[model samples]
Target: MIPDATLAALFAAAVAARENAHAPYSRFHVGAAVLSESGAIHAGCNVEVASFPEGWCAETTAIGKLVSAGEKSIRAVVVVAEGDRLTTPCGGCRQRLAEFAAPDTPVHVGGPDGIRRVFTVGELLPASFELEEQP
Candidate 1:
């Protein structure tokens, strides 16, 4: 298990990114922060559009940044929602996260004290989605 400090930092980064969320349609803001094995932190917010499908998930954005930064894998992630609810990564984002993060990787959902949640990729996404696979 990773230290509490690491999860705390990731949550803080997620909150910062949430401020950048652009959800004009649903008005649901979201943020995500991904941690790489090399200790680089990448943050992203949901970018929505009228076309809908054109918008990107916060997790995907963070993953894109991580990839651009030459990260081969993700160690952990934190997600935050605008409201004080137990918001988690959407299904698509879960699949994407499973691509890079191990099943045991940590994922923290930030919200009001009573609404916060935390789960692993396996817990959120379950099993049997193809990402990069072992030979």
Candidate 2:
């Protein structure tokens, strides 16, 4: 679990990233920030394209950037949004999170309502996880 201080940092980063969201269709801007085991932070904003299928969610972008940079794991992650209600990771992002985060890994969500809730990656996506067994 990340200390509260780290959570604050990620929260701020997520909020900052939200400003860069490229949503025109839904206009539901969202941001995600992830802390990698290597002590680096990655940020992503949900980008919506006219060809919808080409769009990428903020969580996947952050995780992909971290992994492409050679980070094998993430310590924790925070998500932010501008919705009236608490924003949760979409199913795609949740499944992507399970690939890099262990069941106990922490997921924090926040917005105008404040730090609304925290859940584990496993709790966020509890079914049909595609995890490989370790020796």
Judging by lDDT against the true structure, name the best candidate.
2
Over 6-102, each residue of candidate 1 has an lDDT whose tens digit, in order, gives 7777878888888889899988888899999998889999999999789998888999999999997989888888665578888989999988899
Return the lDDT, model 1, position 86.
Answer: 78
**How high is the lDDT of residue 108 in model 1?**
83
Candidates' C-alpha lDDT: 0.84, 0.85
Task: Go through the candidates in order and give the clash count of each.
Answer: 0, 0
Best of the candidates, TM-score: 2
Q: Write the per-residue lDDT of candidate 2 for residues 1-135, one digit (tens) a residue.
A: 677788788888888888899999999889899999877888889999999779999898789888888886878988988866878898988989988888888898888446788888888888846857899
All candidates: TM-score: 0.89, 0.90
lDDT, residue 120, model 2: 86
